[model samples]
Target: MTTMARDPKGYYAVLGLDPEADAEAIRAAYRQRVKVVHPDRDPSTRAREEFRRLMEAYAVLKDVIRRAEYDGVAPAEAGGESDFTPMPVACGTCGSLTAQPRYVVFRTVRSYLIWAKLGRLDGIFCRDCADHAAARASIVSWLWGWWSLPGLILTPFALLANLFGGSKPRRENTRILLRQARAFLGRGDLVLARSLAEQAATFARGPDDRARVAALLRATDGAVSGHHRRLKSRWRPGGRVFLAQALPLLALPVTIAIFVLIAIRPWDQPVSTVAPIAVHPATVGEIRHVAVDGLKLRMAPLPGAPVLTLLDRFTTVEVNAATASPDWVGVRTPAGIEGYVETRALYAGSGSRFKTEWCSDNRGAPPTAGEILSRRVSGDHRLLVHNDGRRDGVVKLKTLAGSTVLSVYVPATFHIGVGGIPDGTYRIEYATGTRYSRGCALFIDEMQASVLPMTVTFHYQSPTATRSLTNIAEVWLSPQSGTVPRPLPLPPDRFAADD
Candidate 1:
């Protein structure tokens, strides 16, 4: 026989008997204690003491009346037997004896690895409180679970645990709440019905319960609609809703007036005074250079005509006549070889002529081509061409000897470097293909190296066909001079052109 320890307090404690142990429990405990501490088998002083204590505990606990008397005297001892008690406990919230305390265990990753059991003791609630608690917890889980990324993963588990893991009360409470909602609906108390339906939905434990509550909520919604319609029908024009609806209508006229004021305001605009571009009258001149290298002198004005000879820059040529087409000029080379060359490829003394009637800036005679040419003999020059208004044109630069230096297409504004034309005088020209009703202004800035800058302004209008005009700008710089010149300001002119 195995010997056991003696209890210090009393006979009940000696046998490990709770003060409230019944006769059957007392008898069973006595048998188990005696076998462990039988004096005959364990011949020791401690065994004798254990055996005696066990017998004494059995004597007092076997009788119901005796156990009750002992419990009354030592009430603290009753706590030890609380877990084994078959009787129900009063609910913490409902004050009902139907609540039974139960332990709910959860197996988590940490618990599994440590071979540990983690649990919480909750009320073994009666159907009502259990359902209410479960429903409340499930509602919380649903409302807050999706707030975080991790929550989305954990929420279903939390919701399921709250709804069905511990008690069945949540399911029952949902049914009760739904029935109440329906009763309110039948009585035509729509607000109360909707409120109850919503609450029932929150507590619903399963999909089927939730679906039924959803149907109830829908029915209550219909009743709510009818109630709202009645309220609307009775509302007066002076009421808040009526005023809110009328506000937008009242604001429309004011908005229209503001836009009208903006549209009709008078704007002070300048008048345009650009003259139409006329072709320069034909005059004898030499080909100082070709604007494009390897220019071919063709027998006829058309591109596919037979090539008479290939011409390079500074080739001497004599102008015979101006063609109906402004692009081709009839000329004869010093070799007596007659051919047609592009008008843009040569510099001639036939300076541009402007219609005097359209001259906006008649302040002084427009600078002559010769005057502009004299200034370019010695240095580098920067040419800035600004086209005002909607008109567009191409501007070209060539040596007075007829060597084409640069050509730039201008839609609005353009700048070109005349520095490459070896410190000599060159002609500046502008032409447009399209006819314009108003006309456009051209502003030229001649920045000559080591010389005062000169600005010339011309107003051009092409009332009919494409026209070409040429003038002089001086560039004075040695071929080795790498200096960059800046464009001068445009002279004042009386044409308003879009930038």
Candidate 2:
């Protein structure tokens, strides 16, 4: 097993484990680690940071040689500088043999040609790579935490020396790898360095990816040792306290040192200059089609007090608010239907009861026809709209063109403020005329891509209860439709009354 380094900032301390912890003890510590640090289980960031360290340390110790090399280093020393030796021969990024290989990076790519023959490269993340990335993310998240020790910042990368993400190098050859790395790093021989680093990486048990990473790192470091300067300073007085920060950097050896240190700290989201969006107000004609328990709503506007009738499955409805009494919400059906029904089976909170109206998966309720038809709302006053119907994966909304059109992406939910649209109905038209249906024409007067910054406020914290939390996120909104409509570039001012 590997011995803990004199580098007080190393992985051993990060996990609070003894350098000599055995496999069973390590496993036991790991279980405890999961309980405290797993993001799904814990609310605090410190636990997650600690967990990454544990994973890293276990990776190195599981190997024989790497562990030995690690143990060989003095515990009080920063980065084993006294043990390091320089090399003379050159190693390339991709190569056969050399005296020194500063680092190596293996990239996996995929490619597909248009009904052609042989292809070259493409971009893909293997399962191990993805997992390592996720684990790395957890460490980064923990470091950039609201309440974390600065010492915890760089430890994750060092710990990563333990994993290539769930994939383990053959345990049998662990000593061989360590022997090679020691020889290579101590003397800086390209051929020897590459060989030893490769061996060390190959024998890594978990996420270390030592050989693969070293090959890449060798080239980048290029005999330049200053990157390790902070590591050197870390060995000074009171250095033990910051060892956690400095040691991890030596393992990963990337230029992200300062950024990572800062990122692993806490941050508050900045408020946007734009105002929050609002839901649409309900109307009469849109709520005609709601049918429940023999209560059928008309699809079109009718005189007030139309007799209550039998409910049908086709009947749609909307509501101004949630159900509290008998637990029913007003729906606007496909036929412009409206009225109240059992809330248990229906969605809640809509201002409009219009059928065939537009709505966003992001929205809490259905919207009105004008609201659905109109898109690209002004964030300055928080665009308002209502949910029209329950059509899964369907984003139906009206545009200023006065036609009931569908959007390319899922529409977000909205609630209207006290005031109505400043100008009731703005007209829109197509510059390119896209075909959405057998007979409908699609337009893109002001088509563009945008992802709105949204937040979900939950009422409770434990298990996502019906309550709301103050947390928010910048949601990515993009086009599901392939093309953007051309611009008509018009206002009432563009056309005269005589024209």
Candidate 3:
């Protein structure tokens, strides 16, 4: 093979023309070059080789399908008049002579994080060869194509293209049927030939093709055919064709189901045989706070037992150990309602007190009042927040859109100046409670909170060259007078700190 046959763009160079040269120019150039390099005229070895290369270039340039392939472009239509020929060509796979060979390109992509590579298989193939090529490319791509970001995007298109028909010039159904009809006619199978020729005549377009089909029909006339065309049956398991098509599609779902079954192993779970805690003797009335928020007071000690009522934080209850279970204590609410609450849900002291000594460690060494917990931007304004409530407080300055810009901790009855606040409208959310839990980073056992009903605004102004003004606002969690709006109740979950 000449270098022109190996190089895609060298075909144009072999014809002594640029890539932009049209079909007419290519044909004219080939005609002019052929005369000088004609082997019969020169009768030399070099002349024969040059003439062969020249013919190769002319063959590709003259046909739309070949030209598009050489140019790395997808033709809008395939198998035009110049593309189809009645002469036989050797199939790339089987190497047998076939009248209706299709030029097809199957593609697959393997991608990495930063790069990707395209794998291509292109050849002129007969029907069985093309089917084998398409199936092989699609199966390989389905198995290993999606390895990177680009592969995720490119692999699917490649797989679909291969599975459907591949991206290349193809003989249409009419031409294929006619080719089969001719083969049957050569074998003297007149009945099948007549049926196929009749079908081809219906699909034939243009005067020449229609006339050719008419001639085939006339030759096969009067042949009685009993055979009828039928659609291929749907794929079934254990069949070679079915496995080739459906295996890739079903691989992911089957793998996921296997993993789920292995991970859960619901069938082989071991049963727990540990006995429950022994119940203690009776105790009279004892006051305790419902330490946990939303503690369910159930009718019985069991978790699946019906709930009598939902007890909120700081709710007082009289404990009755007389009716207590190993894990539960009987309690009577102030409303004279009785239910069994989990023992862990009740605290001995008032809910306003800390649960343990460790929980109270942060009380004296409270977080710096003006500490900026989170800051998006710095500005020339400041906020002085006062924690007038008996409980310590942490105030959060959040944008009206609910994004927190700053947070400051202020101990009970103390005030702090928080600086470096950006100039924007903000909602002042404040939480006040007894002792802080480091785990929760908030007052857990007893907590009450609310947000300012109206938003506060801070703006910076430089009125003159020598004079500069910065906005400063003073906010009090507990309003000394009716002028300030009373804080609206904030839900515990909303005021809860991030983990």
Candidate 4:
């Protein structure tokens, strides 16, 4: 019933019929169109004219002789009432002939969030093949098309259109039908040729169409009948067809469930306690001193192995034997705990006697425990630094702009009070080691620097009208446990750059 904008003067167009429209389609279209444009019911000039054209179209198309004449096909060439044979072409799916062949393109759409794609299958097919193709395309679209923005809007419409016979060739050309009929006739396929000729007679409109279909049908009628093969449905397994139709619908939900289970495993793992390493008796090699504070004695050679205990600087450990990993050495601590420590953390001699090239320099005498090595400006605010560990360190105070405004040297078991600090926020950074490098102005060996997590503020205020108070910040250079904030490690190059 959809209004078609085909040729305005054409009889088929007047009734919204294509050249391929059969008797029933033509009648149905005429009935649907006539109700709206009936001249008697609606007294208008346009309605009267439309009604006249509709009647003319119906009169000619309804009668066999008159319709053939209007289409310019000979009534003799147009088969009789009992000789009905629709267009017969070699079915694309099967080699046998089909009376009704339609050119159809089934479309499918898929979406992946940001992108979308359109797919189609084009063929001149019979009813069964066309249905199969449309079913597959529609199923795939329904499963995947709703995932993206464009597909959500287009997929539903596409599926609906595909379900209803899909789309056919836009232009009607009976010449192609005539040519196919002639080819079949030449090949002595009388049954197929006659069927094609009959279909052509319905659509033939011009001198060329009329001449070709009449000659083909005449030859087919005169030719001797050949082997006739009736059209049958394409052979396909029922189970496979059902599976193919159903799998895509089930696949999406199954795949999503699998992905979700993989992403969030809700199962609990079995719990077990770690067993302690068995102690073995072995000859101890020369004693090695722990060169660094807070050195970890691990149960295995790996850096991430469980820590047996922490070794303080200058703590002595008995070297048992070399482990497979050269970086790690097997040793027994003073507490009889057997473990492995990094080779770099062990010195053959005492901490004071450990020597290196960078440690030998004496460019400037080392500062006293509480001496301020350098000061950019002076103020009443003060900072107290305590080094309770057995390692000497130099602490530097830098402003937010990265300027090193103050530096202090705090030795082992020594506390320092750095005064004359200006009233501003400052970051506390420090380096610790055994030997002080005067040349490098930093600890040379076993050197470690860190920036404290908390910044110190030196805000001065008048407690009363006449009494003034200066803020003081106190800190311990040793690492603290529990809820206390830990200092973040800093690269030696970055720490030395300020000095």
Give the candidate number with the greatest lDDT. Answer: 4
Ranking by lDDT: 4, 3, 1, 2
Which candidate ranks first by TM-score, i.e. highest? 3
The clash tally of candidate 4 reads: 0
- Mark the regions of model 3 whose C-alpha exceeds 4 Å error after superposition: 1-58, 61-90, 97-107, 112-124, 148-150, 157-211, 225-242, 254-439, 442-499
Global lDDT scores for all candidate models: 0.47, 0.36, 0.67, 0.69
* Candidate 2 Cα misplacement greater than 4 A, ranges: 1-88, 93-105, 114-499
**Local lDDT at 115 for model 2:** 23
Candidate 3 has a TM-score of: 0.38
lDDT of 1 by residue, 1-499 (tens): 0111112247666767654454566688788888888977898999998888777667756643334233333233443644221212233345454212222221111122224222222433444554555555545554554555556555555544543444334665465456556555666767766776666665787999989888877877765665443211111123443343245335646877878776753221111212363334445453333333467899888879899987653345678766788778788876798888876655433212122122223223333211222222333334545544243444445444444455444443323333323344445444433322122223332211111233232333346734433343433222224645433323222111111
Model 4 TM-score is: 0.28
Ten-residue stretch with the least lDDT total in model 1:
101-110
Q: What would you estimate as the lDDT of candidate 1? A: 0.47
Can you write out model 2's per-residue Cα lDDT over 10-117, one digit (the tens) per residue? Answer: 755655677655446657776776677777787677767766776777786554434544554555554456634222222111212232222212222121222212
Q: How far is candidate 3 from the true structure (C-alpha RMSD, Å)?
A: 17.7
lDDT of 4 at 301: 92
